[model samples]
Target: MKLLIMSDSHGWADEVVQVVDRHKHEVDELIHCGDSELQVDSKELSGVKTVKGNCDFGADFPEEIKETYGSLTLYVTHGHHYNVKMTYVPLSYRAEEVGANLVCFGHSHVADCFMEQGVLFINPGSMRLPRKPKEQTYVICDITDTEVEVSFYERVSGEKLTDLSRTYSR
Candidate 1:
């Protein structure tokens, strides 16, 4: 399965749409980790699954989502409730409770991907307000039964961050 994940666009609707349109054909699912700042019904989120961020107002969005794609169970969230900026332990525990093979979240606006205790955790960062390494990134995860290849990309330019891409044994 191939999954495209993005987050914290914070209202860069056009860029979000462009990124999705560009990669929709190659991915099996599209996910938005939130702070999109667009209405839940907005066209920008038409075919994407999203969770609510700290900045998101109203109750239209869910705090988290558990979804299955083939053999992979994904735990998706916006990360603020779990205090992601300080640590990922809470989120990891939640993923364990949900029996997830992967966890996707965004709130710190810093792109990152790593494996811990057999679970893969990914944060696509903020396309609009990226921090730290500041690459304005998103992630395309290609999964198989034995391994996962994570490819990070620049949302605006659609260029892959080759150096940041990695493959993990499952």
Candidate 2:
């Protein structure tokens, strides 16, 4: 499965929309970690999986969400409750509790992706208003039964920042 992960748009509907439109053909699902800052009924997010952020006031968004695509269990959240801006140890533990193969989150405006304990932890950062590493960034998680290939993308020109891929052993 190919999943396009995004976070922290903060209401840049055009930017977010453009990104999705650009990659919709290759990805099977779209997941938004949060901080959209747009109404729940916003057209830009019409067919995507989304969660709530600390800034998503009054929107009917859940604090966390779990969804299964094929055999992969995904856990998603905004990470404000876990103090994600500081540490991910607690968040990692929680992902294990939920048996999450991929834990997705946002809130720091920083992009990151890594694998630990056979699970993938991905933060797509903010598509707008980024604070670290780049002006805007996100990740595309391409997965299969034997491997997962994750690559970060810059909002400008859709360039790849880094490629982090892993293969599983039986």
Candidate number of the best lDDT = 1
Off by over 4 Å in 1: none
* lDDT for 74 (candidate 2): 94
Specify the poorest-scoring 10-residue window by lDDT in model 2. Answer: 161-170
Clashing pairs in 2: none
With candidate 1 superimposed using the best TM-score fit, by how many Å does residue 70's alpha carbon deviate from the native? 3.2
TM-score of 1: 0.97
Clashing pairs in 1: none
lDDT of 2 by residue, 1-170 (tens): 88899999997899889999989999999889999988889999988789999999998878899987778999999999888999998898899899898899999998877778878888888898888775588888888887777788888789887543333431
Find the candidate with the highest TM-score and give its number. 1
Please state the error at residue 73 of candidate 2 in Å.
Answer: 0.7
